[model samples]
Target: MRTVDEIFNEALTLPNASRVLLVEKLVESLDFDEDITHIDEAIQELWIEEAQKRIDEIRSGAVKAIPGEEALAQVRRLLEL
Candidate 1:
């Protein structure tokens, strides 16, 4: 079995989407075992709704749009990806 450090080090080299998937799987493993699946699903749904709302707002000009590159850069900066 891989040590946590080994897994994490390898995870660090993954693409952003892959890293997110890995993290989600790890989080769900811990959370599901503890029976927090409902809470987890609720939070995930909330974020999806929020993101969709933001997209709609942007499309309607209710919110300003950022360049995709700029948004990606900000996410990478925040995540240290």
Candidate 2:
């Protein structure tokens, strides 16, 4: 059987339209619980709200922004990697 990385690399080479159809078919195959739609909506809404709060905090100088590379380095240190 083809490994996941092999399958993924093959998928990446498809035209954009075909790649979209492939993704739709793959998601359909998962056949998630009917309640997953509602759960996904709630999760997305929470993330949107969280993003807005962060934006407001940064604008108000309540929080300072750091470079993404610096943040990633801090995370790697905390994880001891």
Candidate 3:
């Protein structure tokens, strides 16, 4: 029998579309006795949407941006650097 790593390596060689389908099947196979909670799924979706909105705002310059060095310096100051 093929080891898990060998199976994973073989799966990696599949085309993108095929790989996506295989992944979906693999995830579905994990649902044995426990069914997914709808509320948890909805909360996860909301978090994804909120993150996308924040990313869009930053990209569109709607939110003020800080330089990485400045942010790091502020963090270091908070840590008593």
Q: What C-alpha RMSD separates each model from the true structure?
A: 8.0, 11.5, 14.7
Best by TM-score: 2
TM-score of each: 0.43, 0.57, 0.41
lDDT of 3 at 64: 75
Against the reference, the lDDT scores of all candidates come to: 0.86, 0.87, 0.83
Q: Of 1 and 2, which scores higher on lDDT? A: 2
Ranking of all candidate structures by their TM-score, best first: 2, 1, 3
How many backbone clashes are present in model 1? 0
Give candidate 1 misplaced runs (Cα > 4 Å). Answer: 1-32, 74-81
- The candidate maximizing lDDT is 2
What's the ranking of the predictions by lDDT, best on top?
A: 2, 1, 3
Which 10-residue window in model 3 sums to the lowest lDDT? 72-81
